[model samples]
Target chain A: MTEKLRIVQMGLGPIGNKVTQYLAERPNLEIVGAIDTDPAKVGQDVGVLAGLAPLGVIVTADIDAALGGGRADVVVLTTASSMAKVHDQLLRILPYGVSVVSSCEELSYPWQTQPELAASIDRAAKKSNAAVLATGVNPGFLMDFLPAAMTGVCRKVRKVTVERIQDATFRRIPFQKKIGAGLTVEEFYKKVEEGVLRHVGLTESMHLIAARLGWQLDKTEDIITPIIAERRVTTDSMVIEAGNVLGVQQLGRGIMGGEEVISLVFRAAIGEPGARDRIVIDGEPAIDSCINGGVNGDVATCAILVNAIPVVAKARPGLRTMADIEPITCW
Target chain B: MTEKLRIVQMGLGPIGNKVTQYLAERPNLEIVGAIDTDPAKVGQDVGVLAGLAPLGVIVTADIDAALGGGRADVVVLTTASSMAKVHDQLLRILPYGVSVVSSCEELSYPWQTQPELAASIDRAAKKSNAAVLATGVNPGFLMDFLPAAMTGVCRKVRKVTVERIQDATFRRIPFQKKIGAGLTVEEFYKKVEEGVLRHVGLTESMHLIAARLGWQLDKTEDIITPIIAERRVTTDSMVIEAGNVLGVQQLGRGIMGGEEVISLVFRAAIGEPGARDRIVIDGEPAIDSCINGGVNGDVATCAILVNAIPVVAKARPGLRTMADIEPITCW
Candidate 1:
């Protein structure tokens, strides 16, 4: 533990590059290898690709080439959103006995939603004696884990409610487009039908909250609707005429005994006013907490992935949740 | 794990009684025994003493009788505030192989300040294969652990600042007097010299934050001053003159490389305006968070003690800090 910890960066996407940038600044960490399936990313210096000075380490598509030396202590994974998609990538890395901190949304709490895959991953991680954790700003921290942690000061929690409102004007182009920032009402519904418009992790966040509170929810529901533009909204990239869709309004509910005990509301709009994050816990000594101006989503996801490295490195070998590992902090 | 968890209530003070009341409401727990040193409380039923119906469990002065049956899984200890005072009680209970969740403040993070005592407790607990944790609202949750947890979304934290302000008018009489609500300037200075009218755990909280961030601090300092009343302040208990002391303002600092990196300010005064808890993390993607109308001190301490029961029960056999165990939630 006296020596600098070695790390491998996998997936050269937006979030992955941000994680690499943060990891590069840490004096206690050394980037030993980089992996990306993109042909353009392969053979390029990871540091330069992430908008930093070249570090002489080239990105390769082969997992073995990056992990073969067995010098890497942990892997920063930012590959996919679904557990099924990242299943093989996890299996490939867990055998190397290197802990992983991933940004996969569903993997944040996959045990309830994808039990079989989670169990398999757990078994594989146990066999290799390596820990795996999936975390990000939304599912990993803000909506679920933070609210659950807040209950530590409560005697009996009757209900938990959270709201995340984001102003999408300054977000990345990809994020803005993903949220349907400038779309017609009809097109938004069509995209929703195609199952690609809404945000991931609301259901996962709900389950994580329930698990932390020891609540047995009878059922869960997620509703996605459009936040119609009342006036013309303009961003750096595009403009939305009045009566068009500005962004999305997503509401997720966790029910027990036909009562909605947990409610999470997410809103991201180009002209959204009062961007903030709020949590209200109805219990003895009730709490009303707010993070003014909200947490920056993209930047925070990178931070969560980077800060969780040491926690995963020391965690017991298993498929872990944010609740399973030690509390994460800035490194 | 299938059977109900048996619990022993130790130290029948205000907090201890509140813990007992909360534990009695849970269907998954059973009150197995109770222990107290007060002569009048020694022969009383635990439930009745806590302002609840009789549960047939009498309070005993002997620790052996409360923990001897081998059925008790955890002990809810609401005893002294200092490590030296509670050292014997911890040693006596750890040997019984029953886990303990205590409200002792200094035990929250004793590694840096009280290394020998912490090591002794760790050794004793390890020998008996039992886990011990110290937690409450201030040292345990709000100041140290909450700030650390908030940094999970931060990339590089330059500074950590926390403020806990309370309005003493609604608080208990003991709490009001503890903060020197009606003391004059002369009396306040005398009490300060006597070292009796100050808060504990601020230094411990600073150290815990430093440990979580992996900062090697150069030195630490704590200062206490009085907040004088500009206008006569009145409370249910008493009234203070315009020039009299309203309450004490305590500040704790963690300095690194001659820079103040961690600062904690605590204020509890009668008629304090805008009581709140606020934390600011100066770093990449800086965060400013607040709990509107600060968390209640006494009630929250009771909640933290009861909520941490399941976490300690499953932790590894040793003296555990809030950072070592799983994230606590309402359970």
Candidate 2:
């Protein structure tokens, strides 16, 4: 019998827990270890922490012990959103010669914002002969990779536009609160200026698409605004009065030779009436495609990470982005 | 500079003409020869035949001469719709040690219908160390491949359903006629029973999806019904009375373990009010996605075929399907 691939789940946050739960059920993958900084979760059984029947593997706080313990072919890292916060954590894993697939939004395309750090990660991955990749539904799939793939059907593409509207009512409480729901417009702007109430990585998505299409961008801009609630609304966890901030509406654009070649719009709010994902390409035989309901964040993020494990395992040893990989096949 | 990939265009039908036109514009590909049986088109410049500015290469009727011409690495076959008709043509090209990407619907997945022909093609491809694949917009992408890729985001998929409703008024006259528009119900049924008036390859798509998901289908069914015009409709070519057939509606289902595991519905006719493509997966988190305007067939089919050339050129030797290929990358 072919031996199952061993996987270590790093971090036990909501996304991490979901990834672990899904990975535990795969016949081809075995969850060998789990890590989390939470004292409450450190000693719990991984299966229990993931809300599954006990599978005997335990969560630990020691990253080194988790890495040193037996064989782990890949590590699914969902620790933090930024690469800066996870740089050391990733550095610690590379030496163990285990591939890593993280959910860091900024790491999805780090050439513009964190080139030096990306280079360091590349060197570390090469030295250890391991692959590293960052992916999520928004920056990785919907906005960048999917739009780029759609252009494969075009002979000469003039412009690309992608829009993602998500209703936060069905999401977890943490996500609902992240969009500054229920905050006043002034308060929302203050929080946005303080870096606490804004979506990250739209610029990264623009850069990724531009680079893939071989367009040298003159400039890239990101604009964020508050979507004020017109009517009182209540989600599963929070209540928002009329005139309060419903959520955030963010737009990013990549201008090439004075033309806007790439445009991306992401809106996540409490009371979006019709939430969907749309991509339009203005080229030969213009394409207008819409996904009626946008991808489910928690579920799809976990699914993409788990699905990427096998691809990363077989990938060339280096720090790779979504574009660098061959076609991503689930089967 | 690296040498460009040499390509040969076979069959100057609407799809073939579009493929040639698109490929002529790519920097990495060079059109070396063109072949068609039409007496009027045999000696015309390939570009002019494709309705573009004249290219230097002239169209030819001699298949052997075209195959023997210099450095024809791949042949884009669009001559016939069925594998039985295209098998000899594929055999003739394989011995020339050139890869092929055909738009043949039956060749998409012929294991159930023409297993012997498929095996023979596989043997020929293996002997020549070349790859051959059949793909297009509907059977290849919208119904089969795209849905399978979406399942990557699913942990446990219970059932998959894809619906494509295309507005046929924008389509060409031949396509409108193929759907039996302007014909009475009796005439439409007679043509369908004679195997000349129905959409092809939904069964192949069903088989492809089931195989990718690893489901053993108990039985598969295909149902063809006429989409009678509700109101008087006039396309560019023909006018349909209120009671005449406007187009065709085809439905295919795959039953597995006493349940329908895969369902595909394709409706292409005059005056579809809200034409779109939708896919739903009843699995973890339940995915619902819709493409506002179903894929533009004429343009996308050509683009997909031209895009597939490089993939087929680099693939392992066999009668390969989309499922067997490593993720298909556009750039």
For residue A266, give model 2's deviation from the true position in Å.
Answer: 1.2
lDDT (10s digit) by residue, model 1, range A1-331 = 5788899999989888988899999888899999999998999999999999998889999999899878899999888897998888998999999999999999999878999999999999999999999999999999999999999999889999999999988888888889887899999999999989989999999999999888889999999999999889888899999988889999999999999999999999897898999999999889999999999988899988888888899898899998767898887
Scoring only the A-chain of each prediction against the true A-chain gives TM-scores of: 0.98, 0.95
**lDDT string, candidate 2, A1-331, tens digits:** 1578899999898889889888987788999888998999999999998889998988999988998955799999999988888788999999999999999998999987789999999999999999999987877888987787777666668999999999887777788789888899989999999998878789889888877666778999999998998888877787889999888899998998889888899999887767888888888768787777777877777888887777788777899888666444344
Clashes of 2: 4
The list of candidate 1 runs beyond 4 A from truth reads none
Superposition TM-score, candidate 2 onto the true structure: 0.88
Query: What tens-digit string does per-residue lDDT give for candidate 2 at B129-247?
Result: 99999988877778887787777666678999999998888788888889888899999999999999878889999988887676779999999999998788876788889999988
Assess candidate 1 and give its TM-score to the true structure.
Answer: 0.98
Would candidate 2 be rated incorrect, acceptable, medium or high by CAPRI criteria?
A: acceptable
Q: Compute each candidate's TM-score over C-alphas.
A: 0.98, 0.88
Give each prediction's DockQ, rounded to 2 decimals.
Answer: 0.87, 0.38
